[model samples]
Target: MTNADKKILKRLKKEDKKALTELYDSYWEILFLSSYNILKEREVCEEIIQDVFIDLWHNRAKLQIKISLKAYLYACTRYKVFAQIRKQKAIKVELFDDLKKRFQYTNPETKMMDKELVYQIEKTISTLPKKCRIVYKLSRNRQMSHKEIAEKLSISTKTVENHIGNALRVLKKSLGYTFSILFL
Candidate 1:
């Protein structure tokens, strides 16, 4: 850690509210930008930054300081972004299911076909190797870039790309006929 970081940590450890406020003032913009880049939502990014400081305040005693404070704060923001994305994805899935049910009431035949398509997709996903499944889900479902997936999974970016490629190949092969109808 840098000398400035050491001083900030020392002051924070002593429960100096002015030190904490100064730290936030100094780093808030950078942290906000980082969170906004990852989350792409203004309000959510603001909330994540707020949560990061809250977490730092709550867990200051347990925090270790082997790395630069900026790096630590960036990591915390990244994790919060991922958590927010996951929550949003879960909500989207629920909303999609609800829409499907509503659509079913209007068109039984279309609903049946939609159900079959979802089943086929699920079966194809189930056939993927474990790591491929995870990489594919993170890329497609969570809308994460290869670098983000790599960081989250603690794998190399190249490895994340390769897994995503393999998963896509398998999916294309399994669903080629159906995909042709949809695309072509």
Candidate 2:
């Protein structure tokens, strides 16, 4: 690590706010660009950068750095970017499902086709690993919050999010965009 970074880390560990400001000034642009390159959303990138720093400060006292500060910050930014992507995807999926529910299929042919699609979706969901299937059904069918599902299943919220993401990916791949979005 550079002498400059070592100094920053020392002050940060001491809960010095100026040290945080210095770190932010030095790394914000690079970190913002790193996240933006993946997410392509300026405001979201800014929020992710802010979150990284906030978390850094929150955990600063016990923080352990086996790598340079820059590398650690970059890793945190990348992780937050991926999480934002997953959150956005989940929102899109929920929006599509909501819209589908609001539109009733009145015609017999349309209703029959909808039933077939739903059946296929169910079949694909059943193919998921047991824990994943349970997590997914709780989230979708029961409309359980991640926290609720985690508590009910005795798992962490992050694990619940991962299972839902995995289920969506598999369903989207097996059923294609139109079917998966509508039925999933």
lDDT of 1 by residue, 38-151 (tens): 446798888888987887776666555444566556556655765676687645544344433443332443344345555656688789899989998898777799999999
- Clash count in backbone of candidate 1: 0
In candidate 1, position 90 carries an lDDT of 49
Where does candidate 1 clash, by residue pair?
none
Clashes of each: 0, 0
In model 2, how large is the Cα lDDT of residue 138?
A: 98
Q: Residue-wise lDDT of candidate 2 within 71-129, one digit each (tens)?
A: 55755665576568678864555434543332224234334434555566688889999
